[model samples]
Target: MTHRSSELSIAFALLAAAAAFTALPQPAQAQAPAASQPTAAAAAKTGLVDVTGARIHYQLYGDLASGKTPLLVLHGAFMSSDAMKPLIDPFAASRPVIAVDARGHGRSGGVDGKLSYDLMADDAAAVLAKLGVKQADVLGYSMGGSTAIALAVRHPGRVGKQVILSGTSRLDGWYPEVLAGIAHLTPEVFAGSPIETGYKSLSPAPDKFGQLVENIKALDATPFAYSDAQVRAIPGKTMVIIGDADGVTLDHAIGLFKLRGGGDVAAATQGFLTEAPKARLAILPATSHIGIMAEAPAIAAMVMAFLDDKAPPPPAF
Candidate 1:
């Protein structure tokens, strides 16, 4: 059950976890390849935006005037825009929300090379530019969260704020079991699983499933991580959200928060902050990594409040 500790992984585990957290057997609606043709009954606008060397599929909810700042959503590994639709809808009513399918996942296309967080982060910024959005509050779930961290690091000017859910900065931030689960994600292991099925059904190039698996396996089997200094260098507000039993360990989450200038509370100042925390952490009770997005309504409320600088004061523990 051992894997190369340096190897970066998590393609299968995310999709597997999605199934584990299934509330119902809802079918995913297919998205058109381009945004030119908006379906009559579509709540969200779907289309493809050309990035450096790939076409990234994206979905938009609400109009630009919905709010001053738009929320850009990044979906996890092995998932498409369909998976993030539910979690982002509630926020759409009040503000603009954009969900993107990362390279090689959902209906997006990928280059014939390795996948890295920096590359994906660049793609995200490019997609925003293509859509006429200069700044946005970035929110990434699972692997998407990791991408959000990278986005903030490389393109700080494009990101207004960050909300990382079920994501970690270092490879070691994940639990041992969680690492193991993602490390063993071979094509055979996911042959008939929902993850594979969904990919086959939604991918623009259905025949590229094996290639996608190999790319993900390579990504997971490699050492792709951001340093604490790199994370600390990101200049913006960040919120770290996770479940009590999430894939990321509490200690690691705290470490990330502290790097972002959080966890300085002490008795000297009565543990009260004269100013708000640049980095905030929220661990939901009785929640797990797989079901974190399902708690989107609550998560959205907190994020909206944080973005508006109206977050409630922390309770004494």
Candidate 2:
């Protein structure tokens, strides 16, 4: 199945699911504690760290002394650490969460050269070293997902558990149009325009549009490429999340399913028993490519539970 067809099938499935669950409200307590909330002494010790001439910005959440696995959340292309606000809130309440602004995005300074996944992975490793965190559960969304995979392959010891949200293992056979669209996005256009406009055209949401644009601009400035061999080389307890109705057709989903352990983006996520195998898959329902995390709290909750090493029931097909 091709990527485009797979996207379409997923979209149809999501629309059907949305019609059935339209009455649902936003999950209460979904947002993280406001900055005004009292900070634990441990949390207060947070500070930015400089890495490879770029001052990588990172904020540590929760009490590190608790010994819970620290989580490192990587944002997608053109997105800053702020993009992680939704997932970070709950995950930080129990274990320490570190959200980073990849170089040239958010607070991090840009460097001259083509952006590569290896370099981004190096940035992640630098952040881990700066925090004195020998190992951490790493989660990446979109572009960050590719980075996480690189980290798992390059610095296996630094990553405990790995999760890739809306991430793919290889760029091979990716929708050519998607790549062409991205390739044509120049840095000047990104700096002068509202980035969200382009994203909303692909997926609907206004809140994070500007930030998304900024991240996209950064990606343009630092173009990164990876090979399928590099992607498959990653070894860790890895989990992948994708929305069944992400506008891509079911053929795309089937192609993914044919990979070593891929399956429906929403229905295949039911086997994540904590005591059993450490890795699994999840295909969230009624979610598009962009809003998967926002529409499905269960997806985020599953991620949090996995990062925390707590057992949670897998997705019910």
Candidate 3:
């Protein structure tokens, strides 16, 4: 193959895999908002909450007690809260934004050999409880979105409206290529990349990036699916968002959406005569797993609108 063909092949491979967290803004982009909006640092404050097996680090923007439900933002594997700024900035403009750096990632510490989504969910709840938030909305991307699913599933009362962006309910929901790519998520692949630099800059155990990867791999290797009954039992309004060309299979996305009470034939037959389903699904065009967060502001707007569920009576002015 020609050099350009090889490059294209590599690019396509990356697109086919959820190889890494997709939303790391270029260091220069920190100051460059995708739109005219608050920077990540605007009104932001940081904290660490002690939880079993982890000292979870979190950043907050806006006031938790400002009365609007806070939006808890979680980053994917190898990403820091900095990665969530796109989703955070828009939410914080209207409500509190609680961005957590999950165990062994970013500034969070106290990594254990058994760090699962359940543990991460509990850690997030502990932080919210510490801040006296009984319940808040959740918006998580990638692995963070899986953590959000675990949170809503395990602690239904703690999550109000939940948004799962590029998250999977079952490991098999991922395309085979993406599943195979997990083994490539070694520290060596990330060496000298922002994933490494970001961890070193923010992690208390900066030397443990390799360990973090191993632990995450272990977590991934563990069985991670809930029975259909368990998923349907959760009593929270949920939205599942995915890119059309994402690592997640469209069939899996639709199945998960249907499991969450997504739209059905009732809508086509009777429009307003029927109530909307509690679940929402969005499939963005021309997007892939790696570019999911490139349009963060737009995604945030959809999430905000979903959570802001107030509605006027009807077609009357």
lDDT values, one for every candidate? 0.76, 0.60, 0.76
Off by over 4 Å in 3: 1-41, 272-276, 310-317
Candidate 2 lDDT by residue in tens digits, 1-317: 77655543443333222222323455444434457332332332345666665666777777656878788999766555655665676666667888887765555664333355677889889888987899999888766877887788789889887887776545532344455344434334433232333333322233444444344434434434444454444555667677776533345434433442443344336435435344566777666666565643466667766665565555778
> Compared with the true structure, what per-residue lDDT tens digits does model 3 show for residues 144-174?
8888889988989999888889888787787
| Residue 131, model 3: Cα distance from true site in angstroms | 0.7
- Cα-based TM-score, every candidate: 0.83, 0.68, 0.86
Model 1 residue runs over 4 Å out of place are 1-14, 19-42, 65-67, 266-268, 271-275, 313-317
- Model 2 stretches with alpha carbons more than 4 Å out: 1-46, 186-233, 247-275, 308-317
Best by TM-score: 3
Arranged by lDDT with the best first, the candidates are: 3, 1, 2
Cα lDDT tens digits for candidate 1, 1-317: 23543222443445665733435422222222345322222388888988766789888887876547889999887777777765676567667888898998888888255688888999899889888898999989877898999899899889988998888876678777666655555677677877778888888788777777677666655666788788888987989999998878999888887898787656226755555668788998777777676676567667777777764566768
